[model samples]
Target: MPRPASDKRERLTEAAITLARAHGLEATTLAAIATEAGVAQGSVYYYFKTKADVAQAVADGVAESLASARSTLGPEPTDALVGFLGAYVDDAAAICAHGSLLATASAGTGSDRAHREAIDWLAERFGDLGFAAEAARARAVHLLAGIEGGAALAHALNDLSPLEREATHLGRWVANASA
Candidate 1:
């Protein structure tokens, strides 16, 4: 039986994400993803026309996962912010641990969508805390930059406690800023 289009696309996306995490995005070629997914090389082309497309899909998947995780933090604003920041720290550390592959992809061209999505998500979350739009945007950027920097440092040191600590600090900062 032929595989459903959605299933094939999902398999390809999963394979791409896995390979990107393991080998870095630059090394995760269509052929490699195809092998990983047990599909033909052309199968990947059917869903994603280029490496950037696949990378974007993987990044989008990550964004969606992060959003879902944040949504599970219940209805409390403070709890949600803390939970989201914690998850962000963990996720950033994981991505950084993927080394140059993920780094390259994250820093590579066409990552504007990922960055914008993240900023928008953070802004919305901050807005939930009754922050003015401008304040929320600035705080969101500050928090994300801090988390990204801290995560990079922690990943380089092979210790995530610092990232966690930094995230906690930022969370408190946000709480105060919202007051």
Candidate 2:
């Protein structure tokens, strides 16, 4: 029996993730994704209009996973921020081995939306703690920048220590909000 269309799309998205991790998004091609997915090149086009579409699919998957992971974050602002950073770093550690995939995913619309949501959530947490709206948003942006930069550094070094240190540092900054 023939597989379902969603199955093929899932296979294609998985293949895209694999290829993007192994070769970075710029180096990953539709043909390569098709080959990796055990589907014809035409099948790739059937599911996605362009490479960016496939990258978007990958980004969507990442966002979904991170959202699920974040459901358990502690209520406190500092703890929540630390937990959020930990979740992002954990997710990044998986794909950042090759490094380019995380960077590429970060550029996608789905990832961008997820990032914005995270910033909003964190900002709200800060607001709950009495921070001004502008200050809360600024802090959220700064923490997110550190998370992204730390992931990139972790990818380059093939070690997660840099990201860990960043989480710790950012945790301190969030904690200082109480002072």
Candidate 3:
């Protein structure tokens, strides 16, 4: 029996994510994705017109996961901000570690709705810490940049120390800003 459309698409997306993380997006070809998903190569085109479509789907999934994780943050605003940074860094590091293609492609482009929403969410949290609205927004962008940069650096160097150091630095900055 043939699988449902959703199931096939889901399988493709999962394969993309797994392969992208393991080998980076540039190395994750459509044929590989299809093979990994146990589908014919042409089926990949049936579900997604291009590899970039698959990448966007992966980005959407990651964004949703990140948002869900952020929703569970503790009540304190600074703590919440710090938690957000940790979540982003961890996710990005994992997703981008092989060659950092996923990170460079998805998070690097600040045009996505999920990225915008994350900025707004962080800005709101910063505002709750008594920062001016504009300042809060700016700080939110800064924090996101830090997370992306740190993750990319860590992945490129194939070391966790950069991620760790970035977390510590960002955490301290958040604390001081809140103080």
Candidate 3 Cα errors over 4 Å, as ranges: 1-5, 88-111
Which window of 10 residues has the lowest lDDT sum in candidate 3? 95-104
C-alpha local distance difference test of each model: 0.73, 0.75, 0.76
Compared with the true structure, what per-residue lDDT tens digits does model 2 show for residues 116-147?
76678878888878889998888778887787
TM-score against truth, every candidate: 0.80, 0.79, 0.82
Candidate 3, lDDT over the whole model:
0.76
Instruction: Look at candidate 2 and give me any clashing residue pairs.
Output: none
* lDDT per residue (tens digit) for residues 108-161 in model 3: 343275667788999999999999999999999998777767777877777777
Worst window of 10 by summed lDDT in candidate 2: 93-102
Give each prediction's root-mean-square deviation over alpha carbons.
Answer: 3.1, 3.4, 3.3
Better of 1 and 2 by lDDT: 2
Off by over 4 Å in 1: 1-6, 89-93, 97-103, 106-111
Task: Work out candidate 3's RMSD over C-alphas.
Answer: 3.3
